[model samples]
Target: MSRTEQELRQLYASTRGMPTGAAKFAVLEEVIRHADALGLVEFAFDVRMSATSVFQHSWAPEKAFLTFSWCLAAYDREPHRFGSGHEHTLLWQFKWMAYSVYQYPEIPLQRGTDLLEDMERRYRRGGHSMHAVLQNRGEAAQFTGEVERAQAYYEEMALTRRDALSDCAGCVPSSQVQTLVALGRDEEAIRIGESAVRSGCTEQPQLIYSELLLPFVRSGLGERAVEAHRAAYRRIRDNPHHLGELALNLLFCVHSGNLVRGLDLIERHLSWLDRPRTPLTEMEFAAAAVAVLSRSQEQNGGDGGAVLRFPTVEGKRRPDTPAAELAVELRERALGIAERFDARNGNTYQSTRIRDWMDTGAIGEPLPLSVFERAANSRGGERLQRLLDQVADRTAAGDLVAAARTRAAAAELMLADEQYAEAAEAAEEAIRELDRLGLTADAAACRWVLARAYRMDGPGGSGVRALRELLDSDPWGREPQDGGPGVSPEAPQRLQPLPLLPARPELEAALGQWLGYGPEAAGWSLAAARGFAAAGREEEALAALGEALARHPDADAEPTDGVLADLLGETGAVLGRLFGEAGAPGRVGERGPTGPTGLTGLAGPADRAVSPTVVVLIAYAEHLQAIGRLEEAAERLRTACALLDAHPDTEAAGRRSTVLTDLGEVLLRLGDVAAAEEFARAALALLEPDDAWEEIVLLGKVLRARGADEELAKLLTEHGLELEDLDD
Candidate 1:
């Protein structure tokens, strides 16, 4: 063997019993890099083997794609170098291709089928061990929506398996179970799975359990479904990397009313879904998370909306009741994941399906504004109009709660469209209905809308008055009177506090009373700070932000804290403006009331256990930029870029693109025109055609400065972003 081959073999042997994670992948990557450098003919085969190991452990689509692409390329260049193991390698290659086709529909099915056919032709040449190849072909057929062909292939494998000597005997039963399930032979599938489990032939136990879960659940065998779920969970518990199996188990948990367990699994593993390595897996994870949360909402007697407003399950809690707060947190987290995925990937068919599920579930919620918001954001006017019509229908049908929510949403949409009169009318109707329904929380939201409408149109004070009433009433803490007009046994006794109403001094004072005390005080204070800032009361905004920072000291530790990050960013801007107004010295370590020019005092805890997030870094940079501290700002932007590189998720990618553009602008100010242009071009390349117009405009400026007018004009014309629109 060549020295490179020896090294590769030694590396693989060293990782034999090691756990799957970054460490294992790190070693594998090193071996692949070494193999590539040596120009070995076995490079493709080596990568394919490593890719199989990764798929078995992590199931990361991007990782698999990288290795598989290399393998295919190498095979094309030197097919003869595959040696005696060529047939086996071909089998595995085709199998992986089929798996990829199943996972990512974006990969055309014909490509996978063509690979499978090639493998079958090779198998026919030697007539040796075709069971595994045939079974995989069945899977590819099924994934491509060719059900009959898949079944035929699967049956052929089943018949051949008894006489064939193959290591994939266990896989045959598992495949058979899946085919049976797809054919609506649930009983047969369950029987086969159960028999395999009992006979000790379940080599791929996770697959068997996954196949059995749906059939058992659909058959109303909750106990059996639970058993399958537990088994599947245990099989993958150590790795916790099989997205498909995890999602299947989650579905069973939700469907069988094991919501607490489902939630636990989600909380434990949801963070792993952050990488967006595989669009299909990410989609599945989001769908499963949303489904679980929706079921939990229903079980708790709340509407199954993406936006969760309720605090308790069934308006009552025994000492044994699970924490409803955790459930709400999970629901919010799930919604965030779905939203981030949608933002990065845009609207794929899978994403749209998940969105539809959320929309349908939102109809059952106290407020369906989330659905309306999504429709408006996506420019799905037909969906918004349909929802409006539904609101009207609900009103005519006297479903007051549904009508009120839909009307409020309609009002928001009308406001967005700048139809102030229509917004006012809709908001008023919603408020009236909500008030009559005794939905204090819902009413408060509608009142806020009405207030905005009033402010925009005729009487600004009406909006302020509405906000004042909401605050003074302390609706969230109010007790329901026995037999009151708007009270029902099922109605929540205390209203959940509404998000901070549009910033008025009156609203600020009310929020202030809860500062450092209420459960939501930090959020309230942040809102108050935003209000004060908007009203040009910088000092008050700074004070409110101080209070917020004191309450949520660990903000930087939680990268998912988008709200807190925004608050911090806004506060940084405020502080920067204050520093600028006072004409402070341009020293790097200049101190303000908040400790440093960069708001370093806001960094939580003494050990600084976690580094500041990209959000915090960018926000601090923004503050520096606002105060004319260009060098410090550029350094902070570099830090943000590093953070983005470390965590290459969809959300991080979006942030990276923004930071690049910002960095380019900073570089331009520093007279590094060439470097700035390069950064701008890189940012442009990272962005999708439909990405934020702001980023595009920033990059356009760089291109314009460099006299790349052709590229600039092409970008503008392609994205339909006219120069006049940019000016607006």
Candidate 2:
């Protein structure tokens, strides 16, 4: 090795040896030179390693800014060498690029565009090139809804450059081939793209060309897509450190009939997704890799004796609801994904090899939400096609951007349809394509959509990680609207909560629980609870609601009162969300309660922690109930109950009693004698209502229990609880 390379080895050695990271990293910094040194052939590798290590350790935004500056330094010298080291320096550099574009929000638009352009020029043909510059550009084109422009840019870029590149086949001719393909010169494009890969030109351009050619090779070339997947797999499988590359190869495996192995590959990514506060880009890679692989297996080759198949019930009959019908309600928005790559429309570009891309399980249409009960007659797979023609056709056309867009569109539609798990996957593909195409803002949109979908779906393990990424996505000021930088978490909101993207309380709570943080967790939990109440996540909104209610300082039996008696109860739910919901019911009396217009909603008189979400529902419910709309009041209570049930952490007793009380009231109004009695009795058992008035309410319990007058007479006389005899 050269002198500079020698130092790099020492840098790696020094860091590897030190138990203490900072000291070791300090040595690394001293030993390795930046990109300027021609002798430092491993410059990109060392710098990337150092960048990821440093970011993991410090995570200070400034540290990242410095690292990105170092990354940019590479371009200053060997501009074409931007994606050096087979694009192995990806996570480190991609994260930096995203951060650089997203942070420093105050930078002018012209400057921002100039910076991106410069980066593209410097790093135009590698994995980093495709995933970064091209992806970002595609996003920009997409966000303005410039479908044709986006398609052209993405197809050209996706076809010409790729990750896992070789160094020998220089990309000029490949670029020419791609241009030819863009002009509809299929034979020329296919020949050049396939030849480059076939000749073992693993250069960045060739790999990109190979990816562009995958569908056609499988379709007519026969087994080329399979061979390419195997080649890609061989290059990546040994090193678990090649997490991103491994994931990509795994995606190909699913379509190539090596799906059993793809599961193992997807599983490895779970580790990354399980971490708290993972960066958005990393999250996208992991989520996409796993989701696509899973789809590939489930969607394809299962008729009769095909290798892959969806799990089916043995003896048990299907549920009244059919799976496909459920899937549509689940993947409604995903319909767009199917269309995104279709070669049928007036707007269609390529999309002929859709079958090649899809090895296939579900390319079925989504059922409308309103027909839930009657939908069991939905598409039964017994007589199913082994492959979905949708994705395969698109892939054959060499329109990767469109393929990815289809997935994203599918994810969005699925989310709208309430099919959370599948939606997250499609969104991931969309993001991957967007990132590759340089569609920064559009990528952000997809990430938020993914996060929001997972927020409701993916289990705590991967879902929370997804949300954290969305929250951490760089603002880039490149949002479709004027939403400025750092407004990432707002991705879930259609309007893009720009100008600022502070975590919603509900999201904060989920992260807090997932991350194992304390106050921050409570804060997020509180926020989420309130948001759900606003959005009617009813059962899911209760726990936060009850604590908020109990913690409010004014939760008493009020000034012989007006209409606000119901509102006092909301304090418990709100506080439950903010502080730990531990030991809450007893603490609820501390919340002030008064009569009439004066009783402000849920919050302690002294603490501003109580937000409006708590007080408003109660007031609204009670108001409506008082106006003789008992049904509305019951729904409000049910809403609170649902919120509590969904909270991961909640005081069990408090959550239970609060929900039971609402159920009791509703059942009583509906005239369900036994049901009302059971509900009330359950609440009374849990709610230790000790006061004279509460005792009177409990007396009604006795009447419901035994022969009305028999037990009541004995209890009333012994307790001296005559309503006629006692004066207030």
Candidate 3:
């Protein structure tokens, strides 16, 4: 084998240091040096933190960016060969420097401009074969919050690809698609993104999968987004270039009721990042940490929850206890590694969205009027003014708890300023007010924020516990007005966890019991079961189902008993199929498909109960189904159906025609020809005279499943279909 060939292989060796021995390193270095001597950037990563990084950078800034790029290539060659600390060393010292400068002007950015432009100009000669340069430019612009400029760059890149046939490879046109999305131009983003998925021209698996994935996520596309994401994952199964993208897509799968997909994505991302020689990245670890942390926070663990820690050194991972220590660590690292080169830059995130949330706590007390005065002059306008007024009134009325809620609105800015202690204090203060006012839900939410801040600052077992409780509780639940402690019995209603959810009597009852507002835990338990029943968590869904049945085994019961029986019977059918019959295990066709036998099984009982979250999913799923997107609709169904099988009871239960359409589709797919036809016939029967366009299509699906598509299509054409047609 050639010497160069051997060195390339050695570059990714299992045991560490440089991945290659000195001789191999020398050969590879010589090769890259030859490329650099000709002005080619073999790789691009930051190198300022290394012993010679600063010297190279200070001596020649342009050379530094290139050298850093090369170092990044080496790190990429086998990043896992290095430990997370080592990668963090390089990541902070160099990789992120570009963004730090772009986002925070306080950091030096002037030095890297020339290098950026150079990469651009040279690539432009190849008829806009400059996606890398354009992509970097987008990163830089976004980091600096130059939104318009960033959008322009990405748009131009997409346009360039369109005009040049050869340009269509690897990166795809994700630039325009996602940039438009981040800019809030969702219609165009979806139009272009979905098209790209169909075209299959994209080779950058990360970019393509993201394009495929976005229609569902950051969107109401519902279940349809599942197949798109899955298709993208399948496209890049063995492609390392798409590993990071693969990981997040998996998350999207999990979001859409594809747990297997989510878990597999985790493995794919880990395996790629875990390359031995360079060492898998700490970024992967940190991301995984966020995922776990996010879930733990969701658990509302009666006592235990996830906690976050900041790095002791500013750019490092360990969060040194005490602000002073962390600050000192940060300063030392900052002094040495702070960029004088191009600022930190990336996709829309600049950093991870998780980082943004961390840097800006979302639940602290309101800013003083002075802060609002400035905010009025800044990005926050009406919301800030309104929030300030509300907060002010609360304080004047001595309603500390009410005032605390306002703090959540203002926490972002305070957190941005690194006022962790202040944030913590405000969260705690709000919790006190809620507690004093006997507002359990409000208090619980405040605790969620407080716990987050506490965790961000240091150790956080207590914080995790608080977060867990909030997650476990029914945020949308309401309480009675007859009488309550520390609150007026006549008070209109208590704060619901999700303010937008329309109130339901049972939901309110369930939440009240969970929060210990008044009723015995039995009500909460019963309501929970009802919710699960509505959601298709049969066993839990039927806890109340059984009670309703047991109320009068014989006929001639009271009117109230009859009403309860009717409600329970309809809901009971769902519950029985979902969790299995009362004491038995969960049944098939009851919930979303799980394992091979348990499509109807719960995502685990804790998450199997009912929730208002189902309403949102059902609406979204129906919309997608109407759009000639059966696959997408199925995915949406999978997700919302899971929620349905879990929720206690719903106001706009899936009995609606839209939900019927979805159910009919699922039953047909599962080959329940008789049941599928039954559901479709019922949905069709909803209209006395004429069927709506969406319902008509749903009828068509029902017929198609029964091998009657030809007859249905003829009838539809004679009648005309318009459910998904915008003009109709």
Candidate 4:
């Protein structure tokens, strides 16, 4: 081959790895250009044939028709130049063009009939069975509301033998299910849908799932309808090609009393209506949007004047449009599109479908899409009963996000009920979901509960391992995999397992800390330190202790004497510096005290004690506090404290002292002086000689409020912090 031909072949081959979308379309277009320039008809034919399928699947029906027309013209002019496989391929593509014509009302219904006639003539010339042609004729009849003619075609097609051009076994029933649904044969639609879904077709559940949504609901199968919605919507949410199916889902959402989810779906896909792939899909989508908006207005005290945000063509949301106004506009748009189809078909089928969706009533009570909401809405055993009823269904439906959360909630209930083993099992189920969705912080929190359940259950070391693993790997994986620059090159020493404590309130509090939970992170850290100390993990205990001190520098350290004795030869040197038994250099009044080590020397290894995330949180908290966002400031500090607890390696030493001091200041601003004082004291306990002067001053304010001026002055004097800085 010439270098140009070789290059063209490489370009064509490269498309196999690409996803089916506009990107692939661009690549194929370039290949076609190159082939046309080189007078390579065979290469151009193959490329256009391939491009036709891509266009068909990627929301480009017009492009599909245009590309297929070129191939058809070329084949007609010189059929002998192309391979026999091209003939079969061309015939297969004829099926797509047959039905696609109905999606465009601009194409006369006579044009559709003529295309089918040509398709039948071609198949007869090729000596092929008329199975595929007859099948599409039924579809065409249904699309035009010729039910009697459609039924006759379907019956005749059913008796015909399968051929090379026939639709796949799974797809045949899937198409019939839609027609059956349109014909109001709800029970038969459900039955065939169930069988078709079980056997699996080309689109499998995605197609049949949406087909059965209305049928399932109308047959009083509420739960199945919900499951079908969850499963099917997830598959098609990102694909604009599934606009019609999405409309079916939206109507299902409305009839099932899930107006919230329906509106959410509308917002997500509203922009697609701007340049919709087909008029049929646009009508379907607009009709669905109208239904959702109309019902939402009813729910809003029947006030159509309430404004709802809808997406613009640029993908930004604008909320100026009133609900009633937008609904009426969409209703007109849908009906207008439907009228074009009706005029072409000489029937009202398309318009009637739109009208029916607009007038549909709720088929059942509101079903909460979220497992969390369902559990929250129920009482006592009802909560458990509701969760249990749907957890299995959601899991089976492959809704991992909902399934994981549901499992986590169930595990919590089991844990509280003291059913430890079952809690562990439930937690494991949630973890599997976590693996599928990627590690969420919530999933990690759920795992923490599992660890506690194992610890409470008995003698196995499972809980210890679980907790250790939780700390070793960041669930968020936000940390650098290589532990960041300047770290040791050699493999770090393995950490010994922490002994399980009899009670682990600190562990629970640490892992459970998240947004919207009131801040108690500093207390949790101190509690964690006490637990670690009791468990005989000296390094981790000291780390936790240091973290507590960092967060609550002024708070009293528990087992202080023991930790001091254990780490240092004696408590005197560190205690003297901390308790004012000695004075420091450069103070307002005193000489430097002699000691083998200072406060900094008492901390765990520096690298092992700092977490980048904890530091960032504290820094952000500082910014939030300065901006008068006191609640957010407090929450950030609490999160930092929780991180300190979660990561025993990230201790209270050094920088964490700032976390505690900052939290104290934020709480003080929020008018909680007592809580402020606790953090101030905890922070003070961890402060080193080089600690920030402002932090010391903040601590002084907390203590001064409670009339501890003399003690605060003494504490400041020992650190050599001048009162002159406080005067400013």
Give one digit per residue, the lDDT tens place, for model 1 in 32-81.
77776777547536666665657544646457656766666666677677
The TM-score obtained by model 2 is 0.28
lDDT of 3 by residue, 346-366 (tens): 233433343432222111222
What ranking emerges by lDDT with the best candidate at the front? 4, 1, 2, 3
Better of 1 and 3 by lDDT: 1
Please give the lDDT score for candidate 4.
0.67
Report the number of backbone clashes for model 2: 103
How far residue 84's Cα lies from its native spot in candidate 3, in Å, is: 42
Clash pairs, model 1 backbone: 451-463
Stretches > 4 Å off in candidate 3? 1-108, 120-136, 156-166, 169-172, 198-206, 235-240, 250-285, 300-352, 356-728
lDDT of model 1 at position 618: 58
lDDT of 4 by residue, 1-728 (tens): 33398888977887876656677888898888889889999889989999999888778888889889999999999999997889999999999999798889999988899999999999999999999998899989888888777877877988999988998877777778878887889998787778767664547677889989988888888878877886676567556878889999999878889776676677657877766879888998899889888988888988773455442333255565777888899999999999998898888888998898887768867665644444443343655655665566676797656655666667777677676655665666565555446544545667677777766664434464466456544443454322331121221121111111223534533542321111233344445544554554434544544444334322122223333223222222332332233211112122234345322232222335336435434644554454466786676577666556556565746666777777888898798989998887777677664665656787777766677879878967877766665553
lDDT of 1: 0.57
Q: Give the TM-score of each candidate.
A: 0.41, 0.28, 0.30, 0.53
* lDDT over C-alpha atoms for residue 727 of model 3: 24
Q: How displaced is residue 351 in candidate 4, in Å? A: 1.7
Give me the displacement of residue 102 in model 4, in angstroms.
0.8
Q: Distance (Å) between predicted and true CA of 107, model 4?
A: 0.8
Candidate No. with top lDDT:
4
What are the lDDT figures for the candidates, one per model? Answer: 0.57, 0.44, 0.43, 0.67
lDDT of model 1 at position 252: 66
lDDT for each residue of candidate 2 in 164-250, tens digit (9 for 90 to 100): 422234443443443453445566566655555545443443244334443443345434444454344434332223343443454
